[model samples]
Target: MAATMPAPAASGHNGRMLSTYPLLSSQIAFGLILAVGLYLFISERLRVDVTAMLILLALVLTGVLDSKQALSGFASEPAIIVAAVFVISGALAATGISERLGAWIGRAAGVHEWRTIAVVMPAVALLAAFTHHVMVTAMMLPLLLRHARDRQLPASRLLMPMSLAASLGTTLTLFSAPAFLLASDMLQRAGTDGLGIFSITPIGIALVLVGTSYMLGARWLLPKRSGTHGDDDYLRLDRYRTELLVVKDGRWTTRPLSELHKALGARFRLLGWLRDGVRRDDLTATSPLLAGDVLLVEASADELLSLHDDPGLDLNAIVRFNDTVSGEGAPQLVQAVVAPGSEFIGRSIRELDFARQFHAVIAGLWRREGDMADRLSDARLREGDLLVLYGRPSRFSDLAAHHGFLMLVPFAGEAKRRVHAPLALLILGVTILAAATEWLSAPLAFLMGAVAMVSTRCVDIQQAYRGIDVRIFVMIAGVIPLGIAMEQTGTADLLARGLSHMVAGWPALPILLVMFTAAALLTQVMSDAATTVLLGPVAISLARTLDLPPTPFVVCTALGAVVAFLTPIGHHGNLLILGPGQYRFGDFLRIGLPLTVVIALVSAWMARWLWLGGPLLPLSG
Candidate 1:
């Protein structure tokens, strides 16, 4: 009876039995929470950050982690670094430094998509190697869109490679990706020295070279689908009509249309003039305007919208105007997309009182299939439907941040904020220097830069506040505890032991490859940083169990975490480009899967060479 009884229980960490469920309770709860969190994250119904908060709440409530553990992520160094980096990026964007660089690159790469990628990707990769990839995407997006519009190239041809390049660039520097920080922290806590600032530079450079060369083939590989509008499309005056009555004491009363043109630089055609209900066809640049003159103007929607900023030159008394004039201010045109889970999804625009609530009129509607019918009032807004909005520019800006819609077009005046560019650049330089020299830690250095940006007025406090993507911060903070739970629950060791058992007799190089492959695959379902944090310790444990060096495995995990190219949800950069690129879900799989394979193979070899001292596998003795 004693011999037939179950064998003695194996030991878990802290002298607990491995077979006992109470010790494994935390692991079970964490796994379920992760599963539920992933479902919500991929559902596209709840916002990503909302899902993150739910995960955090679950961790605390399930007793898998205490309240302090749940809230500790908010104070983590990675979270601080991410938030501070956002403000620094905002300062660059506010001061037009990014715009200037984009413009210069656009001009240099003129008219050729191939030439543009060759120039833009390398430059973006270099910049991304230093800054966060998301910031690099933010700065590069407007410029690329403008360049595509000017050149008539499809956005599909540019965006995928650009996004991919940004992801690759993160491998170059320690501070470039949040995953690296997590890996470094894990390594340090595991009794190993953390990675140096430039430790991964060699692997990063290799990946960039491979990625850029492959991206040059995008001219043929990428789709040439086009949806960007040209100047003529906006210039269709029949679609947008408005009337203006001149004030008797206005500045334009005695001036000719030519003088008004020279003064305001507004490109509008004079259809005719109305004086006491008498129509006159004599309208030209040299045509004189009189008091109480009514001008029938034929101008593009953008031209009509640009009138908002020129309050001094035009005394406009609107008569029966349907658009471009609101009680708050002159209405401007911008683009907004109906976001997932929007209330307007199934309802027609006419029923929603969209103009009253949003303070904007939909001038036109664009769907992925094509433009909706001209009767936009009756059209139902769907997720991903792009609506051309006409309203006060300030209101339009606010509407962009509303949960119901995602703003696709930026305000025109943003480019004009170039006067503060020098200060923004100085802050960027000092932040980089401080981090490099260890004068302050990476997070503190960036925080100082962010503070300087606000204090020096490179970016106002409000803009700085708006620039910080709370979703990203919350996501990072929230998911970090899940990683901690994995270790605390002995889940990392359990998983690592299982993996080691499977690959027990495998050659060293193949084991490293397996580690990278697993890490890369896991990133598709969750964030890279979260995957890195959870799996970093597992990789170290697996290496120890296999009697191999842990550095190679850790390095493999870090490099693999950043190669999240298999799915759109794999990286925030990919998500940012999804709507603008007009990409279907498979778009990423088509371009990214191959890229992932190439990058993983090359990266694996490089890791083996650098950390293992060669690419060969040891004999399975």
Candidate 2:
């Protein structure tokens, strides 16, 4: 998430005159007006970042907060920590450690659904909690989908589970969820105390268990869409088929296919031979003696094209140049899924200059629910849109490698060295040390880790920048001032007073549950960071008025805000998988609602046990 400016102080220059209005009512009214505007009109009309900026501007104009306060969120530690987390996550991805883990999981679990879910969910969650969920989702989603397709498992069965696993994985730590960071900052600002690394572990663990159980049950509840039965159609191995020609004047015309194989080694394979359009299945090592013969082969377009240009043989008359481009000069076809928070979202190929800038052609485009457009050039791409590109082989490969875009086809060519293993392990070690020893703050340790990644070349400078979600940073910077405004205007205190008056006779447990539910619901409609920023202070004020520890209520508000799963609007991770998972709007509601409820109940109880007294009782008015 991006950083936001805090609202100006109430007694500032403009506030000196605006002070004629009652501070508490005016502040509450201002906050309500902004919140309603965001919820009802701005949300549907403007980009979230734009709307957030508008809110920030509103706070400043109203004298609810000053310029410095409004911009403070950008400089906040939580924002820096999140930015660092993204960079580190990118470094890990560049090293292929995340892929190795998925490969290991696939190998270990093989095709068993239960075993796969069990190992994959917790593993991804634990790993992602420290890193960015976007990285985790990008790395794991395609792998899971491919594995499921290979094993003839239902995409419907596996995709949702994978998305959930990645989402749940992020909830394990504060840095894991952007919402947590925002809430933590708001709480600290409100003088309610900030959460330490692993401070939420007790409640987080319980939520995980409940969420996992809900997911396991959801496997039965979720619709089971069958995999495509026609493997040949989906696999499209025929597209990879090619024929090498042997001309009368060619140097290698007299050599057997095995001889060519021996020279080329395993880099190229000889499928069979074609003699005058007649198929020859036998690879007789000694059967040479042929001019004008054709060799049917299984090789990539690049390899075929490279051989086309070799001066050692006469390739002109031997090879038939079909629609397929061959050699390094030939265009390569690659498929990639656009991920959440990608800068490309909402832009068309024309606007992006995708072909001119990237040196690629948009061959095909796919969205989960929408009809495939006749031309990708005119279609606007959204997060989760799958794109097929025809481009220079090297460029296509490079695009897939660096950008978090998932290549639909199995990776071809030599694998990059696995730097992810040591880097991931190092990050884990640092996180553990910081969490356990408290030698350094989590943010500082993570920042150090990000620096290490850059210095060590785990991720390049370009990729590090690409990985950071500037939109989120902007949102954070814009919303922070509004949060500050709520506090300075006495809006939070007023809201808390009103809530306490209404729930005076109700048990504290129910009140806490209501607060948690409200936060969760609001998170679905608004930004999670904004939800926490707005509600956390109110929750804390309520606790303070009741003469109880503010920690439990504040923690509930924070956790509740982050646990929104019922809508794609709630979290970027949820939106990231929509197109790839082939999920509809209803799909999220079916699975996420129960999980949200389960987490809310469990988190509330855990907070009570850990922070509040054994059982919660109503406050005596």
Candidate 3:
């Protein structure tokens, strides 16, 4: 089952390695590759996708696996399902079905804070169960923020619950997250029936209830800060930092001052006018621009930086680095996470012209560690900083890019298109019914659904392509070979035999708990997909050694992989809310530790009852 992949990840050393080497045994090669992969994974040396491919390359070069076996994950059922789900999620967003559902839920919010949360949080959880949780969070993010503004409640109170609920939703369905899908893929590859669509849903119900109740009872622990989602506070903290530069060959030199104001005034705020380094108060709306004249205008740091890209006027920082400069860097703010390959990523607001470029204002920014309002104008942008971008209805499409940015707050009374919603809904519903009812294979059903989205024009092909998170796709595909290598090399059996001896006399409950706890802990430090990939084969081998069903062990491993409540880095959804909730790293510990414990206990308990029925009684009997 060889696979095709995105050119970037599939290229590099793989080309030469395809030629092969017979120098080492497959076991030696597998062990060496595993060691190096672990080092790269832990050291944060390269992107996880790159590291995965490197591991694949090692496996093939040393003959641990053929190229087809090494790259099989790209064509696996899990990969197809995961990639297809992203497109379906995008179609929902494009047609505004998810947004419309979120808005309807928002309307249920009353003046009472708890009541409002009661309505919003569970609805978010339910929605997440079917669609991708990150998209669910992204869809609901704006609704909750709007409710916070309309009711004058704390935005902080709403965001963390929404994020947590989205994460918890992963457990409720077979395909909500890659961890679950991978779990199913592993089981199927082992010659067992894969997970049913709602197989773990009972456990999900318990976890969701536990999380919701915990957030409500511990409301006092939630941050009370104004959701730093608005740029108004930043405006108060610092006045306009950028001054407009009119070059000798400027595009706007012949245009009237009023005309320029009317065009970009919504973005780059024009305070007044200046000439020859002097503030000119007498400049009227009808005043004509001059070749060398300067205007006192306000723009975001990134927007100012983006001005360098303009064909006309240039930020003088290039001409005179020290002349009237605020700071350096392309500081592009984020809405949810920066769209994965966004032009704005890694650039500071000062480095790009967000205001004029995107026709948006950075009202508030949320970083994982600190409040950004203090240095709002010059803060460097990262992938997961939830930026409050205030722009008009016209800019919504570009701001979010068809569901690329999850959990972004939108302008009040944001217009949504219902025209395409019915067709999108029908396509998604048909796909789910066909798969859930066993009329079609999950992968085929989802693939058809994704294709339907494009054919039906619910979302264009470009949008569908954009919706797939290549990092996740490549990471999963790259690592699948590790499992294959482990099985093919007899390493899993070796490790499994050893584990059986240590737990010879113990009931399976405690061992299950241990396995679950280990998975949960590892998920905190790495991507859940990686954790699941590393541990899943071991769970399978161990179950076989003990003469017990592998399903529960695998299920528990997946459950733990998905329960990443203990840290923000555990999941992208957590980082999505990190800034909006104004949470500290310590806050996750205080809030999520208990939830993690509860989920672990509930998951192991359920897995035992569902799959084991009794502890492993006669190991190797």
Candidate 4:
């Protein structure tokens, strides 16, 4: 029944009339309102996913798009591509490919910062240009974190640069990001030919060259944190001194240590025995403890707290007399920085109900430039601020994972289940084959890959859904209709006519540069795909008016849309690193501005030279 539904056509102006009338006026207005709404809601309180879904619902309700058309984006090729990319990335991560790659690069390049940056940045960039940057970030972040920790190199220096490289790299190939696919689809719908998979490679390679050069040079300009040596530096826990206590029921309270150890081995360890307050060094599993006996423990502060709450044991009297006792039974404490893209972003401790909600006591808050707040719950949490909380170990880990917060301390647990390398490679190969052979559409191929991952138990269905960013999916769906509405309303043509008149006498090169720069700048403020869809058609029209080849203009628009490197707000990858890198807004401006200029200049030159034949002037009327 769903498949039988009629395909919806755009109402109002047709393509021919759009060129003459006020084209895409409705679309522009709708897009602006939608964008503002998204920004406000996302900034204030609502989850991005919720906001996106609401927009989609509005579109369907308003008849801007039919239910089928509204849901089309979910089944679109780009969406599938993104989903498949996530799976491949997960498989690659599970197989430890990224870690092995980092280790190899580290060994080959030695410890010199520049050499390491050169080797790792290019490798990551190349991979990112061909796949999803999110996957690249997810796979590489942990590896780089571990590597930096191991080598005593400041993670602050590496994370941002690496994230930047991934963003830049995705600009190199048409299939590199979902934005490109969206652009390609828009172009096709606008009566322009779709771009080839590698059509943008020339300009993309140029951007990468210029961008990577800037990153390598900017490494010295970055701040270096003091502790960089591997896990030991971040995870040292000497402050925590744990001890155990036996339960005394006042009657029939004799139990052998062997029985307790066997029963609780998964949760606790009995280090030594105490009988009548005398310590016994030779305590074995079989040692018996009477009602008044105690057990000395050396475990994490979190572990000790967990045992304190166990129903079968009594730790109250023992904790009172233990020399390790701190304030009111609260154990050791440590400070940790909140990572970027963490669930804690835009959340207040009071809002999160830190104490009552998560059962943790807030101790202190630290920010880079702000004065320290006396109370943790009173401070408004921001990305990169360090938090000091008192809680059990398992509870902290749960909090970190639940909130997408990073553990500043080494994760002390068994590694998660991972997919085998060969199997993952096979799935990736099949996906590529499907895309290349056109045997299946890109979306279907990716969807199939996601299904394969789940069916094989390489990753669970729950994880597959989690792997896809539902917020991004909703944003794409809501925005895609706006593009269609733009085409339907004749706004795109009006904008193109205005631009053509403004650049009437300019050489093709400057006109092309202006269009590209406009797109690149707008991308910093809007979604890249939205920017491309709204602007690509206008760029194409401007080129046509000049009697210049449209290919160059299209390439420029696509390239510019993806090269949003000058600000954290420009791209998600940049935002992903903002917290972890401990970077300030100024840091992005300092490094990204120069990089953006270089990419813009190089991309324009490449488009002019390779496609436009030395910047042809507009045809005289």
Candidate 5:
């Protein structure tokens, strides 16, 4: 009779399950939308913002959410703060604050390479703590390039480290990264105390210290690509091609070419030697030099300038990229680096025939490969390859646009409104103080700061508008609704239940650790903001299921999303340095793997200390 009772209960359980399945119809539709959304985001088949719009539309049509909920994200506080940050950061850059900071960095660095890294990286981290990470990285990029060139330091060594520091800065403040802002917004919407402006400072300071120390110590692990050496210094590296005539004053008439090469010593490369207007084909290291022989020498501007001191060689017509000859009119000298996704990658200058197509001379090629001087015409171009071209100014622009090249030299936009830099800095300080003291909300404080920037002419209104990244704004506004729909449709609960079941026996620390780890893994393939949006609801629900405060869990997830150290694509800051540093994908993994592990452990522990009390997990009654 007892066994028969069990069969009836089993049938009743099955019937209840069937009823619940029917009631979860909207949940099932939301799930399909989510799957497709994640696929579109990860595959990048469509623009992220466009994909987000589609997902929001699907949610409304499926009746998972009303139009109000979907559109609310556009006016959300987090989105406002994000857009304001761009304007503020642009003001800082436009008003010469960043450039002023560069001067301070240069002063602090003196002449030591290690000093530069120590001063610059931490300073960059601190500035980025309150501004856009990419703006900090981009504004400081040319400064570092110039500094590195002046000091004759390897650029690759400093660029990756700087980019990494920009990412680390996000951990220091709630508003520094979109992920943290979104996380804080989620916490507030849950009726919990949100993260303060500097809530993450304790853990952030520790991580920045660890990151800076690790980079300095693990310098050996960083790639030493010197092909891009001396990029910004005028005529610093292999930029001059001139004719040097062997003269009789020093009696070089019987000397071999080997002696000339040995004497030049890193100053120049021998291209061709001509005697009596005839190019020598039999030229060898042992070939005898003639008194009246003209040697085509490739050298730096400075190196060629100093050659006037040599009595044995007379400086003839400076044939720097045939600057003296022009079919397209007065030639302009421009330095261009290959942009990302360029078709020029893997193609040689000889194949493109710049001389025929644009009538431009590919005078110099700087690559990370280390041996680009001898084969400028035949060397295959790679992303980040810096080329010095001699051509008409208009043609240079057209060619750069046609090819995927970013002109870095003769850039007219570096003009900074230095007079207003002080005002900009003061405004930034006031904004931070207001938010930190709770005098005004973060969004309001930052928005006020942006307005002040325009009013003070720190950044013109047009510049402020241009600074705003429309794609990110649209993406955040669109995807915030997805998180809302997940909660509305009970999808967040479903995921929370499943995750809880997976970690049922886990202690408190591991739960936080798992959240952090999951965030870190998801962000490598998607933007950090998107990762936070998708994970924020799940995290909140998971903490609720464990009967714990959601702050630690949410904060942990944000920290994980911020590091983005594992790959260049993980963050725009990383991508900004990719070509300049000429780092391979594996370089990020090698350096970032250990760094990511260290940050995860420290951040999880810190979250436990700061937000959680005694138990890592709540004790079951």
Candidate 6:
């Protein structure tokens, strides 16, 4: 009779399992979308923003999320704060605040390589504590390049350290990186008080001190190449070339090439002469020019455009390419690189039509693995191709923000609104105060600052738009829905169960070490924001299973998601320095491995103290 009762119980259990299969299938669908989205983002086949949109569409169309939920990420607090931060940081750059700070570092950098690094790394870190690191890096890269060139310093010595410093600096503040915000949001959703602005200050300060000291010793590990070593090197790197027509009444007719040099001075170099489709390959300075001949010249983009005002020379085929070389606005020179998987990869610059697309002209194109002297219009761009672009100062900012390329220089010209520096600083200070004091939330405080910047003309509406980094906003917005799906579909619970089982019966500290290692390794290829969202709930769930406080695990997971020092692609700052620093994949592993270990240990210790209510190392009598 008891055996008969067991048969009924088994039947009931089987019925329940059959009923739950449809829900499980939906959860798996959302999981697959997340997997595909991450693959596309890391592969760089589509831009980050575009991949985000695709993820959002998948969630809504599959019924895992409704239309409103899919779009909720745009309305999230973190997205608002991030967008506003872009404008505020732009104001600082536009008002000359970043330049002024950079000059202070430059004055200290005189002659001694190590001394310059000591000052530069700390100062950059300090600035990053208060502002966005991406903004700081963008504003500082060109300034550092110009400073290094003028001082005859090696860029290899400064760029990697600066990028590393910026990455560390972001950890100092709650609002600096999207990881922290995501962690806080997760905690609030789990029915706990979220992280405060200065909750992690002690850990941040300790890491900065150790990191700064470590860099002093690590400087010898960097490559020692100089960015602009000599005049010939500069011309080769710039790769600026154009054809000029010798007019009938122009000064070059019947004159020696030496005479042309006498007129243009050191500004331009005559490469060769072309007449009736025949080229003179080896022309000396004494070679004579004739009317209607075409001269292939090497010059800066600025010098090339300044020719429009000169009567002696006119741009060859000026009628067909007038819009490009006509000198229509304030001229500025910028360096940008075609990114991997760029739509521009197989297209020529002439076909892409920069003048129509970006309001800019392609002055030259450089491929690191190929000859630098290739004709600009004829060269099909490949990944890592450095482009020398000329355009108006205002327009270059938008071009710099394009998803197809990475901007090496911030802008072609300095911000003309230097007088607004004080006002911009004041606004920024007030915003920080408001957030720290809890008078307003992080998003509101930053939005107010952005509004003040535009209203006071510290940055105009157009400049504010240029300053906005749409990729960051779109990425955060799209990933938020996926996070929601994780919780709603029981994926978070399933992951938590499996993870907790792996470390069952472990001590609290050891458990934290296990979780931190997993999060850090995942962060190497995945974004910090996405990593935080996925791991935060798992940490909380694990804590519940172990009957331990969840805060320490949550904080550990968040910090681990941010320490991506293993590869250049792991961090945006790393990618920003690749061209200027001339770094390879091996370079990061060499310098980053030891540093990552020390940081992980320090963070684990801090987590034990803050959440466990005891020191990591207990003293014995």
Question: lDDT for every model?
Answer: 0.72, 0.67, 0.74, 0.63, 0.79, 0.76
lDDT by residue (tens digit), candidate 4, 100-209: 45446556645666776777777778778656786676556655666676677887777777887788788666677767888777767657676656667766676667
How far out, in Å, is residue 9 in model 3? 50
What candidate 3 gets wrong by more than 4 Å, as runs, is 1-25, 231-417, 614-621
Evaluate candidate 3 by giving its C-alpha RMSD to the native, one decimal: 16.1
Instruction: Kindly list the per-residue Cα lDDT of model 2 for residues 1-621, writing each as its tens digit.
Output: 123323354347567766656775566668676766567432568776777777777777766777888888788877888788888777766665665666566666567776677767777777677677767776666566667777877666766666676666656776777777776776677666777777787777766676666777667766666534333333232123334566576667676666665433232555556676676766487788377676544443334434544433323222232333323565555667887777888887668766656666554454655543322345688877766555667565567775546455622322222423576568657865775476887678878888878877677778789889887777877777766777777778888999999888776678779889988888787777777777877887898888888878877887777776788767777776676556678988888887777777777877887776654332422
For model 6, which pairs clash? none
Candidate 5 per-residue lDDT over residues 1-621, each given as its tens digit: 977998989999999998787449988998899899999999999999999899989989988888999899899988899999999988887765665675566667766767777887799899899888888888677667777777888878888888988889878898888888889889988899888999989888988998999898887899887434345432344445446778775646688888766545343688877788787878899998877788777765434533543556655432333443345556555677888898788888778866666667665555554444333456788888877666676566577566477655741123346456678889999999999999999999999999999988888789899999989888989989988887877888889999999999798788988998999999987778888888889999999999999999988888888895898888888887788777899999999999899889888877887888643333522
Q: After superposition, how far is residue 383 of candidate 6 from its true place, in Å?
A: 31
lDDT of 6 by residue, 299-349 (tens): 644455445435666666452354764334666556788888889988877
Clash number for candidate 1:
1
Error of 4 at 423 (Å): 2.1
Cα lDDT for residue 554, candidate 3:
89
Q: How far is candidate 1 from the true structure (C-alpha RMSD, Å)?
A: 10.8
Give the range of the ten consecutive residues with the poorest summed lDDT in model 3: 410-419
Runs with alpha carbons beyond 4 Å of true place in candidate 5 = 1-23, 227-230, 233-415, 614-621
| Collision count for each candidate, in order | 1, 27, 27, 15, 1, 0
Q: Compute the lDDT of residue 8 as modeled in candidate 1.
A: 41
After TM-score superposition, the amount by which residue 86's alpha carbon in candidate 6 deviates from its true location, in angstroms, is 0.4
Candidate 5 C-alpha RMSD relative to the actual structure: 14.0
Question: Candidates' TM-scores?
Answer: 0.67, 0.68, 0.67, 0.63, 0.69, 0.69
Off by over 4 Å in 1: 1-21, 228-416, 548-551, 579-582, 615-621
Query: Clash number for model 2?
Result: 27
Model 4: lowest-lDDT 10 consecutive positions = 410-419
Candidate 1, 100-136: lDDT as tens digits: 5655666787788888888877778877876668878
